[model samples]
Target: MVNNKTCPGCGVMLPNKNLEFSDQYNASGECIQLYHELSANFIMSPDVTFRTQHAVDAYGAQHSGNRVKNIRTAFSLIGLYLAVEREYTGRQVQHAHMELAKRNIKWSSFILPIRPYALSVADVLNIVEVKRNEMLMEWSKNVWDTWENYHEWTRNICKSYLKHF
Candidate 1:
């Protein structure tokens, strides 16, 4: 029950699959580790969330890159979220002004810089938030103006088809 928490819908190990049916064991342990961290702490715990080299070797080399990419995506999102908090919340979350030094960006370390940037994480966060808000607003407006009037579109399509017929 503690270590082997399988999906409610399936009876396989949480991280292992019963390959006869793909959906039979879909809730992965690695996935749940990240999910619980985000749900409980609202922050990414990079150390705890990914597969080891042994696990990757045991599973398949083909999936190794995907596992690392997923871990990196979590880290990037946390960085972006911290930047957003710095933009709007200001000292509310720890590491608000923090950013990766140019050399350290390639290493993906969480170390505070020896000489931090004047440009600041908050500026990056604010830009990200603004861009995200702009895209979301545009998408919502497009959906409202286009897809929400699906009945009218269908009617027009039918009318145009009848005219051709």
Candidate 2:
């Protein structure tokens, strides 16, 4: 039997065979596997657009640590902010990401929480199919809430760069 590996970031355990994985973001092979499972739910759903966007932001933000690039982390947090605060749909957040990418907005580095996520893709996956979407949003919100230190910065950046979107 294969041994299980634990993700240092979110504390999820997955079966491991010592395969190569990204340590920069604390994404173990198991963590990526869990993410893939989460993605499959959205990918196979009729409401793919909204759920996909949320999964992207939620997973991205939850996984981002000091080892993650500032730009990518900023994108993740901004996406979360727009989705949760502004009630932007997944499509709108995607457009906002594109718009922000075009501008010269300076993305600031965040001092992410030591444990960036309390909930993992596994948590969402465990919920009943009918309530999965709600659980996904809850996961997103929980991840976003952990990055509370950067809320003002995220808000200001969106306010300045994404006002028209």
Candidate 3:
């Protein structure tokens, strides 16, 4: 029997259902997972000042989607070196998060999804840290190299970001 249940993630009616016998059903069998499209038109506004630490935090919370553009604008007028380094630093964090998605899986420790997309930069960093630690614990010798790479990637990003200040 087909349940025709609604998928929560995609909000679509799917073909998930029961197989004969004991009427056991799989709700997620026909789920349509939705990909989060990046925020649109993030750089339309004027450049925000990153002079103060508060401004930096606010920018991360409010304009994380358009980080590169804003950083370029704000720093081009104030400090070009900072602009370039920030872009480099931000891009690295973004890349590491993307790579984390493909390798994320949990059985023994059951780590949840990091959900790096569609979130503020601070939230993304926080969630990714949690997931990274979980992955570190679960990683065996076979996957140790990949895990180390991710760790080093984030560490370097932090170093680059700090260089801006």
State the TM-score for model 3: 0.18
Model 2 / residue 113 / CA error / Å = 0.7
Across residues 114-140, which tens digit of lDDT does each residue of candidate 1 receive? 321132111222345336333322322
lDDT of 1 at 32: 36
Error of 2 at 118 (Å): 2.2
- C-alpha lDDT of residue 28 in model 2: 79
Q: Which segments of candidate 1 are over 4 A away from where they belong?
A: 1-12, 15-34, 41-67, 70-97, 101-104, 108-165
Candidate 3 residues 15-34, lDDT tens each? 55542211111112232111
Q: All models: lDDT?
A: 0.27, 0.80, 0.27
Candidate 2 lDDT tens digits, 48-138: 3566888887877777764677787888899989888888888889999899889886666667686446788888988998899888888
Per-model C-alpha RMSD: 22.3, 2.2, 16.8
Which candidate number would show the highest lDDT if scored against the true structure?
A: 2
Better of 2 and 3 by TM-score: 2
Clashing pairs in 3: none
TM-score for all predictions?
Answer: 0.18, 0.88, 0.18
Best by TM-score: 2
